[model samples]
Target: MRPMRLLGLKTFRHGVHPPESKDETSGLPIRQFPFAPLLIVPLVQHMGAPSIPVVEEGQEVQRGQRIARPDGFMSVSMHAPASGLVRRVALAPSISGRMVPAVYLEPFPGSTQEIEDGTPCPLEATPEEIIAAIQDAGVVGLGGAAFPTHVKLKIPEGKFVDTLIINGVECEPFLTTDHRVMLEESRDIFTGIRYLLKVTGAENVIIAVEANKADAAEHLRETFPSDLNGSVEVLQVKYPQGAEKMLFSALLGREVPSRGLPLDIHALCCNVATTAQVGQLLPRGRGIQERVITVTGPAVKRKGNYRIPIGTPLRFLLEHVGVADDVNRVFLGGPMMGAAAPSLEISITKGTSGVTAFTDTAAERTHSPVYPCIRCGYCVDACPIFLDPALLGKLAATEQFSTMTDEHHLMDCFECGSCSFVCPSHIPLVQRFRAAKAAVRKSKAGAA
Candidate 1:
């Protein structure tokens, strides 16, 4: 392996490291998860405005056929996973606990794996054209955030993106989807970087990985430059190191101001999987009807990485993957910050990067009642973004939404769930902040 000509960038301050159950699935290669007979495609799968449904009930659609269209600037389109008959497009139960618009499809028996819809995306596509192609490809950040990649690629006026920071550091525990993608899909990653460089016009491209995944780092180190004009960089294996602001800081020595974006620092950060998907889909002009996900946990009997079609029912995934016996708790992503679904019956979305299941014994039961803060200041020390979660929780409890912003930097909280993780009182500190922030937004709109 060649030595890295590494330019170690400045990273952000304090963060914590919870137990990362990475070994359970990190070594496993990618495999296809058996398609669920029925799919529930969420309209708001990708970050941004909800996609407007175009397909109607009983319509026979081919694989890769567009079922939804971009409703706004920050949205991406949705596609049929397989050549299937559209059962219906109606309000369905989502992982978000509401009836969001979803497209229900019954997979056609023995549907051939075929879904290419447009001319090959040239590496030299113009900035506008590239963004359009990316949007057309249905590319969104696959790291659970699901932000539209086209929006990130399109730099606004007066904003020059000199650096394209690739997030290779999969900091979240039990989530090896990014790590496995880096290991197995090196070619796709390189191809993705080429497109990113061309679209963003970035002079420098950096792939930041943690020290733990030295193999992934080494693989990228050898393949990146050969793949494009940019470079790959290895950094300290730190939690939240993959966060845009933190990754920018770690690789570029710049800090994105609170409530600002990496764009503010003249940098554009993208998930490695997003780039890999871009490489795979853009040339074929295919929409993101499927994504790679890591399904592993103590509860799962057969744990490995699987390429699951978007909109497949989560229960089917669990059952097919040998979770038939265990799996009382299911996490959509990583355990540290991932959302817990009450049941596995909800359908997977574009953002479903990993499906983590825990057995009854493995699932930690927090029987202790929520107690008052002892002023231990543990959450204060653990916060990576440097917000006082204790105060925010208290204010939220008292319905002081206005004070949460006027005094505390409530909007700055990205709801990373760091504070909640370290809270000695078992308080749902992050949830309180989320509620408070939502309330503040509501109050502001009411005032207007």
Candidate 2:
């Protein structure tokens, strides 16, 4: 046990400072969002193989009961979010605009919604057992990546992790779900940290937070347990600072090798919200059924943080939040990296952290004319990864997808949108890069 040290503000080179639009919901406490009559629980809410349905249509399930089982080690299980009868198990619209297999559940009106618990994993459980419990619990990176948490915790045969980093640096604007989770779920966070420490065998822990979340930092400092070798490090406010590579550079000054993982550098990073879920669920033998989300934007009349059930349809959520008549576009997650909803019928998944509704006026601001790149070097100056987006953009325009990856390191671009944000020419640099990368992947897969 050591005293939790509050480190001085630190940051990596080259990032943007988008307007911090978090004030609208940062102060709001998380409230339980009312369930929609029909919950569309997608089987592919996470990365990897979609969970296979274990309960069939017309079956009754209690809240927290396992509805789908993980297909394999790379996948995670799924649970019922409420006491309901399975209406159907068919293809449903997901946030990604894909029609994936899903369970359509209709909640019984006035039901107790009692949760069915499984075998709890105790603190003293072995690392092997803990990892199994986590996968069975269906925890994933709630910070938007939705990578299965159990898969991440399983260290490779030869690799060793000495440090565990809890990421609380929600640098994306208009998103305060992680901030609210930090303030309200401190106890669960610490408990999650313990589980992560055991799973990764990390002797030291660092909770990385941006200076913009001073209140969250202070709250965590006050509640930090005196038994763990961990500290809360406040970082300089910057866009994409929460990325795993950027966090490594800002805190440890270590650059993860290009295309390498955190474990390559003896470090493991987990989202604060994800960690809190691990702490909150494993001990209770519960699977993840819902998550905290920040629902806000200019077009929203009731902006706040909410504990929303998984599979809640976007249309229902927006209706509950009261959107403006002129609401023209709605996106899941933050503006910089979120995807626009192709249909409001798409259901929220584990990866969704924020819901932003923009009016026609707000959407029109981004419709500026696209001009040729002037080589003003603004994109290079703003790229956190130090790749030349201008060159990559040109290669993409010429359909030189292979050249873009081979010579310009186009694949290294995380599509943080900083290049597009700072580009004076208003070119869709990030969008172009995304398309180019997809082309490259398709080519490689076809050749294989």
| Tens-digit lDDT track of model 1 for 91-112 | 8777778778899999887967
Residue runs of model 1 more than 4 Å from their true location after superposition? 1-11, 227-229, 324-326
TM-score against native, each model: 0.94, 0.98
On TM-score, the candidate that comes out on top is 2
Each candidate: RMSD to true structure? 3.2, 2.7
Over 294-364, each residue of candidate 2 has an lDDT whose tens digit, in order, gives: 99999999999999999999999999999999999999999999989999999989999999999999888
lDDT (0-100) at residue 355 of candidate 2?
Answer: 95
| Candidate 1 TM-score to native | 0.94
